[model samples]
Target: MPLSLAYAADFPSFADTVFILPAGTTELPINAAADLPEPVRAYVASQLAADEKLISINQYTHHHYYVVAEAKKTADLTAEALRKAGNKLHALLKTDKIPELFINDLTPDGALALAEGIALSAYQFEGYKTDEKSKKTPDLQLITLVGPQLSTEKVQELDGVLQGVYLARDLVNMPYSHLNATQLANRMQAAGDDAGFQTEILDFVRIEALRMGGLLAVNQGSPEPPTFTIMEYKPEGATNEKPYVLVGKGVVFDTGGLSLKPTPNSMDLMKCDMAGAAVVTGVLTALAKNKVKLHVIGLVPATDNRPGGPALAPSDVITMYSGLTVEVMNTDAEGRLILADALAFAKKYNPELVLDYATLTGSAVRAIGTEGIVYMGTAEEQTMLELKQSGNRTHERLVEFPMWDEYDDHIKSSVADLSNMGKAEAGAISAGKFLERFIEGCPWVHFDIAGPAFLTAPDSYRGKGGTGSAVRLTYDFLKRKATV
Candidate 1:
């Protein structure tokens, strides 16, 4: 990817792309803008005004969305509005090169910093040669601005957070052909050192002693050793109130164990099964880098569900760390089984909050598709409201769901204490219920991102790969709680 510089008095030579105001374009978009290059503007106008019968609107824009008047209304609000609108443009306007937005807001550094985070998140890894030509992405990087008040310290702070987002995306986008348990531990260790956090990668010997049955059971089927990564972020002037505990199900590669999944796309991208880990890892990195005055503990149970000599089977009964015996009714329901153990472990810390995220159920994909995070937490309306607001701001959609006891009857087992999977009807709801059981009464939140973690098509701030979901929403939620 070649890099060059240009000048634009009409915009500015320093501006890679100028924010535009198309002819007769009105309304202040709190999310998007009426901006485009000369060619892009003409292309958008031509498409809106097609051949035989042209659509009639005083003004026109791209065909990507329905040219909503709402996007136009959002642009003139606050820096928060401008920054969010910039997020949409950063993804929607990419051409031969990656789309990058350089704003001239003269805005507060906080808002500009958020924009940098958005652009950094719009990253892709396509170094590996492939047959799919369109799969290749533009190397458009770096959103630079020239402002008298833009301090060096502000850019450094924004760059650190942006780097954390890219680091998480890199880990999520990397194929399992390269990443395993040990490799994942090494990645976290490197991030931990770089971000001023402490990473303790527990090897198989320690994992066995701790009896992480779900993690061990998943790894038993694979030759690769399992890793339990514990990261602690304790900043200065932190409060004694319980810290946030984040648990991720790190099934490095889930082959469905004895109960193999029907043929699907599992060649190179299975490594993203640890996306929860990647997100939590990145959040901790940001917190540590900024020296956020809070306590955050990240728990990742890493392994692979495979079918080998020592693999646990459907009829097998295993003891989870929580001291509950689970009947492995189906090996494909491995994520919850692992997360249950970690969630239970989190209780020992007596934390004020615990949030666990996973690519838990296929049914979730059927529910919300690939653009939202399915969330169900305790009866904490204010907390959920904060999460949802942050989700909207960060582009990590969080939708609330029910976690009632109506489905508990499904898990009752004849052979063991409980069955791994219930009747397939409410699989997503059942998975949430299963996680809630371990949280016991803690204000726990469960995010089943099965639908949104991976994309089959292009989305905002996303390409054709692992969309680094949840990081922005959760991080923003915590930052609001911390600083706001």
Candidate 2:
């Protein structure tokens, strides 16, 4: 069940309460701190003396509980730190099967960050589990914020962002057996309906008419048809005249086609290859739900690369939507092909900026592991710096790579204008350079999300499986843009 948040004028009688206080402080920050029973107060003080960051007291006689969560001092606190603290509190409460709890508000920013972390950590994907015992639904469902600092508007904005993150994670975690190319577009349309965005789905015929050769070539291997989804969110009195375009590579499942990937670790998590598409959808949803006054557009070209049909093989040269030919050196390099067509298509909008996200290279994962995003772009230095700041604020950190002309030489082909695969060294930068061709001088950024898009193990509030890597970072960036 989705967790719900409510506002309370004061701490309710006989309700379990969580007191958020600064580190090393024995006194609760609430006005009713003196009203607690002597034994509970003594126990909390003792736990604080021992330097326990979290203190739980079971007041069985009073039929309630008290959880004291110590946060970093205000001078030392950051958004990421508060979120990590919330994740710790969530784990403790969930383990004990606590059904509901009330939290004393700190500052507005601090409270909202804590709530966001708890809600994100509470996410569960048990849809495929048949047995009831196997499903691990979160026990903590209702989170009531008690205190005046957090306004209803602020809480609503936080709720929208959390919902977006949950939506992104759910899409990435879904097996291809349950979600295919057409279904992915339909799901995006459904999200648009719920969030007040406009969605236009272009079927295979439309794609063919547009001569999207790169997308079609990738779809040749699969029985499923391809879909190009366009989503627009333009609120009244918008801040920008030209929309900011976001393109996502939607390879629903990747078997690497003719250049098949190994089954163990390489192909096992291929279901997450479309995580970039999910991030775009998630960001649009958050923006629309929050009613941010910014014009944004999202494009996703989706298909699965299977070897069952007439798949493109090595040494085949294919044309893209931009009328540029690319030699298919490795079928596993299919993501850039589909993304190329979408990036080319985005040019019609005369966008202010274009950003494309994809799990496009294993070279990126090898370089940075699952800790950070590898990005490179032709956007101005100020834009890149702002994006980096947003990433840092959300803890979805980024590591920039160069897009030097030297890397462009690696993708040159004798038979075509370019090659799908580049030289073995600096593979990630070469992939970015390949994509830069489609922008046609438009300011653009490419995020190689192969590393942080999914995780094999749980990481605090990010959880396991799909990490919803770029949603938070991009949403933070867009939100700031709207205000500016």
Candidate 3:
């Protein structure tokens, strides 16, 4: 259970009341429902129904109920309630059969955690199993309460983000044989359509016409064709809200081209190269799935960085959409090259804010270990504070690094406008700087989720697979921005 909402009256270990509720039960009073704070009350009344929507049920094992209160829902309460309810819900499931339970009638946060639980529990990438020995994962279904009124907006927002995370993680966990570039594009299109968004997969002809150098050059090494997937989300009633644009580097598999990586496990996680695209695609999915009143544009520059006959070389030069040329210092630094072109492509919208996520460098893992995203923004950085607040709110985390001018010289190229990579001193920063070149005249944040995107073991509310790291952090940012 997530401890964000766990409280002492029911769950002793958790100091807050964060937990999940089961399906089909009567409305029960919480032990301390009467003593809730003014803000919490407003959160509950506005986000959760007093007695009409969900009966603020007390601590009970496997008990779920909804009341018939005529009221509105708020975002904060929904988030808090879901966490509080999840703690209790998990406790109820201890040693018992994992129920394939789904929920309805939640405020935003309430829905957030439920969606989180869905994404958390839906992790299964049993690709290389010679013997099929299976047990059961907690089969949980969620039916959220969203409408014109009395519904939590942020909860719906996070729900879309969670869906995107599930899609990405599932793709990563799936066997590579079942997921090539074309297959990835098809799935991407399907996700966009299902989630109430528009998806477009640019074929090689279109990509070539647009000069998507990084993505095309990288795919020259693979038999599979490259794809530049674009998904857009536009809500009918949303107005005056600047669209949030996201770009993900979806190198479906990175063989480092001719400069192949050493070590036996080098190729082990290659399938996850598309993780960045997965994040944005999933984010768009959440936006569309929840019918958010926000405009979002997602760019996925997807390709396989494999060494093929026409693949990029050690010292190739390619022009990006921004009209800047990059010397391929190392073909392995292909993520940034592809990102540069995509970032430039997204500038047409002049997105109020542009964010990019990529499994860019290993040095990021060396910096923050494997539990947080390595964030790099402008001199007047803000995501650090935002991420800290989000950590408290949604639990996904990020650690910001200085994007100072001192690192500028690191990326100074000898040939062409710049090089795809720079000195080895601060690889993460160099990668960030490389991407920063693509994002100009806008509020931009770059997240290097080299670590924490996937986990080796389980802990707290996460399990032994992709943790769906920034989905909640991004949702919290959106929620905070939305309410303000």
Candidate 4:
């Protein structure tokens, strides 16, 4: 990831420690702050007087130096707060070059938050930088958590989760030229090997034989053939008989086909279109590494949508894997096509639940900026509730929409079973309704992560490129599901 997390059995004394105060009182806590050098303590007090949200101070001694931060009062250290604190520490490390840092006097939850913040905020996409050595950002290689509450096991688990997030972020940030359909499947295969999972890649020949018309139709334009990647992790004594199937839209680059996207920033960032697939890959890696007692499956339908020869056009009718004819009213609505095939294929497993993630629609983005995800599903209320809770815990908040039968009417076509495009209103809901037609028996949830998947600007710990939107959300959900 952006930074590595280190642990120590006990760091009896470290100059650097974050001093957290409660919301109201400014009095020095009866803790480590008491032992800090007088000048450092006075400097912290002065910064507090100036109303600094976070203040750092370093005082040199004969052998070593001390680093301290005075933070504002927080009644209960929430995950977000810890993350923010971590971000503050990360900034200090980069800008001030404070080599050794310690987090003192935080509860288990508080320490985890700070760790998440620091880890998540430490990402940088310098893969193509030529002056790599000269321009590399100074990294915080070692972080020691000082307190009785710190759990070594929990810290390790969080590190695994961060590795997955970083992997997804890296995949999403890659240029489409470098990450094609075949390359995506290869990457998944490599990840499976590293994470102790099984991977199967279906090339153009296999995809055609299976009659995945939706994936094929979307891939008609690109010279780079399509690939369908399947990943599985099922161990003995797994909690569920049926696996949880995850489908991701791996449009490596979406040129919007014949419809074509607007020039510059609009189409330029289309490389991030495959973020959903990256999330699936990352989540599977985490689950495998953690050895969670649950069986899971991930499917990525990979391709690039372009206006090359034989590109899909408006009103084109194609039969999905489920044998339902879909009239493609808009070529740009391609994610659902590949996802439909995968969802239908998921029926083979009789999955307990099938969830698909996609940067599907602009309407969803318009409905909720980068604030949250727009999700709709036919899954049971209890399952949906669990997912919502997971989303909140991971800060990948979900904005649920109704999946009423009336919304399905928008996708009805005269000749085909359904149309890819629906009415202008509630476009996101209509897209979910369309995918619902393919899943006949199992419970399902369609995540329109368009809004929060990629950010034009950075948001806190989430950097400027791929946000790795739903990896944490799904990981937390599956962990809780495993226990239940």
Using all chains and alpha carbons, the TM-scores for the candidates as numbered come to 0.80, 0.95, 0.76, 0.93
- Candidate 4, 470: how far from true, in Å? 0.8
lDDT of each: 0.69, 0.87, 0.66, 0.83
Clashing pairs in 2: none
Per-residue lDDT of candidate 2, residues 58-88 (tens digit):
5552223333344444422466676777888
Instruction: Give the C-alpha lDDT of model 4.
Output: 0.83
Error of 4 at 386 (Å): 1.0
* Residue 136 lDDT (model 2): 75
Model 4 lowest lDDT segment of ten: 61-70
User: What's model 2's TM-score?
Assistant: 0.95
lDDT of 1 by residue, 245-358 (tens): 989878788888889876666524466788888888888887787677778999998888889988989879998887788888898888998898889889998987898889
Over all chains combined, what TM-score does candidate 1 have? 0.80
Best candidate, TM-score: 2
For 1-484, candidate 3 gives per-residue lDDT tens digits of 2111111112222122322333232332354244455565555555343233333432334433332322226444345445444444554444333333334332322434543544454445444555545533343333333222223444444455655666767776654687777788888889877988888889889999998777777888888888888888887876436777888888887888888977466777777777787778777776677666778888887778787687788888888877788888788888898888888888888677888888889999999888678887762446557756785566566677888888888888778888878787899998898888888787788889878776667654556566566776776676565555
Extract clashing residue pairs from model 4.
21-73, 22-73
After aligning candidate 3 to the native by TM-score, how far in Å is the CA of 207 from where it should be? 0.8
In candidate 1 the C-alpha lDDT for residue 56 amounts to 15
Higher-scoring candidate on TM-score, 3 or 4: 4
